[model samples]
Target: MSDATTSDPGTRARPVDVSERVALLDVLRGFALWGVFVSNSFAWFSGYVLLPRAQAQALSAPGLEAVVSGLYHFFVNQKFITLFSFLFGLGFSIQLARAEARKSSIVPLYSRRLGVLLAIGLVHLVAVWAGDILSTYAVLGFMLLLFRQRSDRTVLTWAGGLLVAVPLLAPFVQHYGPILLHGAQAAAQAAKASNEIDLRAKEQLLAGLSSDSFWTAQAANARFLTHMVPQSKRLLWMASILGRFLLGLLAGRYLLLQEVERRRSWHHRLLFWGLVLGVLGNGAGVVMQRLRLAGLVDPARDPWMLAMSAVMEVGFLGLAAAYVAAFALLFQRERWRRVMQVLAPVGRMALTNYLLQSVVSLCLYDGWGLGLIGKLPPSRCVALTLIIFALQVPFSHAWLSRFRFGPAEWLWRSLTYGRRQPMRLAPGDAPASMTG
Candidate 1:
C-alpha cells in the first residue's frame, strides 16, 4: 500500500471511516475470538491450569476426553492468540498509513489510543482476570512506533528475530542462566524449591477463585498478577506477542488484505507452508506435552525440553498463518463468503466480545457465580465455549444494527479523542461494511 499523503497537513486525526474498514480482518478477528475463548475456557476458566499434574490427568478420561484434549493442544492452543497479536500489529500499520496520508502526526493520536487501551487493560487485569493482554499490547505498542519509519527489510528482520531466534534461545537461557550464576547443584535445588513455591501459589489461587466472595476472588487474582509481573517467563511472552504485532504491522504497511486477489499466489504458498510446518511443529509438541503430563519429561531436567518448546512455539505461528491463508482463500468464494460473513459483526466488536467472554466465563465457573470451576470436564468446557460464541454472533449483529460503534469501542474512541464519538447511525446510513 502506497503511503497516504494529503495536500492538507492540518487535518485532524480521527478514527478510520466505516467504508474503509477491512471485512476480512473483522471476520478473522471474530474467528480468532472464538478460539481465544476455547483456550481460556479449557485452561484458565475451567481451573485446569491450577490443578496439580495428577489431578489434571485424572480429569481427562481415557477415551473421548483424552482425544479432545490432545487435539486441542495440537491445533488450538497458542494459535489464535498468535493470530490476534498479528491483527494488532496490522491495525497499527493501518493507523500509521492513515496518519502519513493525512500528513498528521501519529504519535499524539496513537499514544492516546494506546493510553486508553492500557487503562482498559489495567481495569480488566485487576477487576476481572489475570490473563488480560491489552496492557501488555499497549506497552509494547509504544515500541512499534520506533519501527514505523524503518525500511520493510528492517521490519521483517526484527520480527523474524523476535519470533524465531528468541524462542529457540529461551530454553538454553532458562536452563543455563541459573546454573551459570549459582552452579549446577545449587540450581537444581533452587528449581525444586521454586516448583514447590509455584505449587503452593496455584493452590492458594484456586482457593481464592473458588471462594464464594467476590472480593476474595479479586484479591487472589491481584496476588497472582503481582507474582507474575517480575517473572522472566512474562518477558518471553511479551517478546513473542511483540513479534506478532510486528508481523501485523508489516501486513498493514503493504495493505496485505486489500491486495489479497493480487497476491493470491503468495497466500497459497503461505497456506501450504503453514500447514506443513504447523503439523510438524505441533505434532512434536503434542508428544512432548503428553510425556510431560505423564511425568516422563521434566522441563527443568530434560535435555530435549528446549527443542520441544521451540518447536511448539514455531508451530503456533505456522498454524495461525495457515488459518489466515485458508480463511482468505475461502472468503474469495461466493458461497463461503456468505456463510462466513456472520462473523464480521463479531469481529467489528471484538473488544466488547473479548471482555464479555471473560465476564460470562467467570460467571459460569468462578466461585462467586456458578462455582463450577474444577468441576466441569474438558468436554463440557469446550461445549460451553461454543455456546457462548454462538450467542455472541447474534448479539453483535443486533447491537451493531442499532449503534455505530460497539460499547467498548465507543468508550475507547471517546476517551482517545477527548470527545464522545457519534454512537447512533443515521437512519439512511448503511450499516458498517468492510470495503477497504
Candidate 2:
C-alpha cells in the first residue's frame, strides 16, 4: 500500500481507504492492544484492584507469579497505554494533514468524529467497565484541536512541561491541598475518615461485582465511576495523557514514521537513549514498588515519595519510545517485518477488539457470567490474557477479510458521517488488503 495521503475536498470527509494507511502504525496499534489487554485483565478485570490490600497480596503465587508481577510492573503496566495515546495523537496529526492536503476545513468533520468517539466512550464506560480509557481519551482529544495551529516548537515545549510538571506537582498537591484548605489537624482527621469510607466503598463494590445479578454489578460499577474515583486525581492523570498526545502530534507533524528509513539514524539514537532511560526510570520504579511492598519505604513520605513520583511520571515514556524505535528499526527488515505484520489486522480493528476484550473478560470474571472474580492468580490471569488474545489474532484476520471495518469502527464512521458505511468489501477489494 502506498503511503500517499487521501484528499477529497470535493466530497465530505470520510474514513481513509485501506491502501492509504501506514502499515507500521496499524502494526504498532495491534501490538499495543495485546499489552493493554494483559494489563487490564491482570489488574482490573481480575478484581485484584478491589481486594483488600492484605488479601490481594495473599493471592499472589510465590514463585512464578512473583516474576510475572515484576515483569508486568517493569514492562507492561503503563507502557502500552502510553504507546496507545501516542498513536491517537499521531492519527490526529495525520488527519489534520489530510485536511490540509484536501484544502478543506477540519473542524466540522473532526469534531463530529470526536463527538462520536466520546459517545461510544461514555456508553462503554457506563455499561461495560469502569476501567475504560476511551471516555478520557475522547474528552482530552478535543484539546488537541487547540494545538493544531500551534508551532512545532510550541507543541513540543507544552508537551515537555506538562509531562514534567504533572508528576512533580501531583505529590505536592496531594500532600498539601487538604492542609491548605483546612487546618493540619482537620486534614489528618479528614484523611482518616476518607480512607475508611473508601475501604467501605470498595468492599461494597466487591460485593456488587461478585453478586449473580447483572444489575447489581452495573449499579456498583456506576457508583464507583461517579463517586469513588477522585476528580482531582483524574485531572492530574489527564495532564500526563495530554502530554503524551502532544509528543505524538509532534512526531506526526514531522511524518517521522512515514519516512522511517530517512530518519534511521534518529531512530537509532532514540532506541539507545530510550532504552537507557527506560531501564533507569522503570528499574527504579520496580525497586521503589518492592520497597513499599516490603514496608521499607512510604510513598506518602517526602524524598522517597518525590523520587517515586518522578519515576511514575516519566518512566513509561522512555520504554514506550524505545518500543516504537525498536519496532521501526525491525520493520525496516523483511524478515522481522513479516512476523510483526501479523499484528496489522488486529490493529486495524483495534476499537472492536479492545471493547471485545472488556466484554469477554467480564463474562469470564464478573458475577453475571462465570464469576471468576478475585479467583484467578496473577499467573493464571496472564495465561488467560494470552489465550484470549491468541483467539483474537485469527478472529481479526477472518473478520477483516470480508469487511471494510470492524463493527465498532463501522458504527463510529457511520454516525460521524450521518450515513451507514459500506461494511462488506467491494467486489474487487482484496480480502486482507486495507490500511488503518
lDDT of 1 by residue, 1-436 (tens): 0011122356776655555577888888889988988999999989999988778888886687899899899889999999988988887887777777777778988888889999999999999999998899899999998998999899999988888888888879888999999999999999888889888888988999999999999899999987778888889889999989999888877777767898788789989999999999999988887887778988766776887766887899899999999999899998998888889888888989999999998898989999999988788889889998999998988888778778999899889889988998877766754322
Q: What is the lDDT for 398 in model 1?
A: 85
lDDT of each: 0.85, 0.85
Global CA lDDT computed for model 2: 0.85
Deviation from truth (RMSD, Å), model 2:
2.3
- In model 2, what are the clashing residue pairs, if there are any? 18-435
* CA deviation > 4 Å runs, candidate 1: 1-10, 433-436
Q: Write the per-residue lDDT of candidate 2 for residues 288-371, one digit (tens) a residue.
A: 878877898874454457646666657788899999999999999989988888899898899999999999998999899999
